[model samples]
Target: MRLFGYARVSTSQQSLDIQLKALKNAGVKPSRIFSDQASGRNADREGLNLLRLKVEHGDLILVKKLDRLGRDTADMVQLIKEFDQMGVAVKFLDDCISTEGTMGEMVVTILSAVAQAERRRILERTNEGRLEAKAKGVQFGRKRSVDRNKVFALKSQGLGATAIAKQLGIGRSTVYHVLNNP
Candidate 1:
């Protein structure tokens, strides 16, 4: 069975050296180590893409942390399911997370469920808070797109919509809205 490792950092400025060291300690070869310096929000990362393509049945993919695998629990769970179907094993060194056997599957599932539930609860609480604020007549969202008097002044000064947008650091659409509606 082949052993491969994947490492990632949110930005190019961050170092992958720590993860690489951990993967190497886990026995993954230097040649088989794939890395990407991109955000987890991006699904088509270079290193992750190459690893998925290169890994075969009976191959094991090692990671320093479970978060290195994907952005969220749902995303990681889906990826794990795909790897399990392909007979590729994924092992998270930090969390002892694996998708190899029945016990491993149970652990991953339980953890994923707990995470998802927590996210849902947080969302519900945030929405409730927003609703309560709205009931008290709280204004939300971006306060008026642009300064009203400024747009009028710029227009009176013979500046075009695009120019007003650039000068105020607002969108051209906002400039038009302020000019046309007023």
Candidate 2:
């Protein structure tokens, strides 16, 4: 049976060195490790999907932590269940847990509950911050374009939509909207 490892960080600023070292020391080969720099909440990460696709019956899937496997508890649980059904084993290095036995299943269930609660708390805090900003009259959106005059000049030059869009380095739909709105 082949052993596969997965490592992840929420942002590009973070490094996977520590996780990689731990996985390596635990006997996972470098070629078997899949790493990604992206939010755990993102479901379509290339590395993660590749890991899932490569896993097979009798394969062992290793992760640094349960959270590294997924952001939401439901998703994590579903992933574990998928692996379980496929006769794949999932091991959490830090937790010293393996989803190959009854005890492991229980641990996973408990940890998944905690992870779900954490996700809900994070979402609540984010919503609270947004509401506070709204109350303070603070706008939350992309900055307005700096070259409005240039856009108007290009439009007045009788340039076609495509030409104006290319010259302004803006989308054709945006140029049309600006002209129509102004």
Candidate 3:
């Protein structure tokens, strides 16, 4: 069975050195390493998708941690189920468990539940923050454009809305508003 390693970092600014080193030290080959610098919340990460496509029956998919697979536990469980259905084995090195056993199943279930709950809590807090902002008369969308001296100068030069928009790097609607409002 081939051992495949997956490593992920949430942002491009971060390095994959640690995860790659850990996977290598765990006996995974360098050529078998698939790394991606994308958010865990993204489902279509390049390296992750490649690993999924490349994995075959009897292949072992190794991850440094459960969170490296996905941020949402439900998603992680679904992904694990996909691997299981494909006859591919998944192991979390840090967790020290193969997802094919009874204890592993329980752990996956509990982790998935916690991840879903955490996602729900985040949504609730975001909604509350938006509601508070609205109650305080704060604007919730893009800032409104204003008529400025530059618009007057451009208009005085016989520049049309389209020409002014092109010159100012703004929308035609913005130029029209400025011309009509001023």
Candidate 4:
């Protein structure tokens, strides 16, 4: 059976050194390792997809942690199920969990559920905070980059939208929007 490894970091700024070292220590070859510098929330990971395509029946996929696979617990559970159906195995090194036994199945289920609930709670609190801020007249979107007064003055000087945009180093669309709205 072939041993494959997957590692992920939330952002490009983060390093994969630790996870790579762990995977190498686990006996996964460097050529058999796949990694993504992307959030677990993003399912369209190129590395993961390529690994998935390369895996065959009886192949083992190793990850450093359960969270590295995905942030959404339901999605994680579904992906594990898919791997099981494919006759492939998955092991989370840090979590000490594997898709090889009944106990592993139970633990994965419970932990995935808990993680999913936590994500839901986080989203609810974030939305509540955002709503409270909006109620207090907090502007949430990007601030205007161009001055409306300046655009108006330039237009009054017989300058077209393109000319005003070029002179102010702003977009022509912004110039049109300012003039049309006013």
lDDT per residue for candidate 1 within 1-182, as digits (tens), equals 99999999988789999999999998999999999988665567888888889999999999887667666666767788888999999988998888899988778777756655765787799999999999999999877756899999989999998999999999998888887898
TM-score ranking, high to low:
4, 2, 3, 1
Positional deviation of 158 in candidate 1, in angstroms?
13
TM-score for model 2?
Answer: 0.71
Give lDDT tens digits, candidate 3, residues 1-182. Answer: 99999999888899889889999998899989998988777667888888988999999988887778888776787888898898888888888878887788678767767766776898899999999999999887767655478877988999988898888888888887777776
RMSDs, each prediction?
4.7, 3.8, 3.8, 2.5
Give each model's whole-structure lDDT: 0.85, 0.87, 0.84, 0.89
Better of 3 and 4 by TM-score: 4
The lDDT, on a scale of 0 to 1, for candidate 4 is 0.89
Task: Estimate the TM-score for candidate 4.
Answer: 0.82
Among the numbered candidates, top TM-score falls to 4
Worst 10 residues of 3 by lDDT: 140-149
Comparing 1 with 2 on lDDT, the higher-scoring candidate is: 2
Q: On residues 1-182, what C-alpha lDDT tens digit does candidate 2 reach at each position? A: 89999999988899999999988988889998998898777667888889889889999988988888878766777888888998998999998889998889889878978877898898999999999999999999998873777778987888988998898788999887887877
Residue 42 shift from truth in candidate 4, angstroms? 5.7
Q: C-alpha displacement of 131 in model 3, angstroms?
A: 4.9
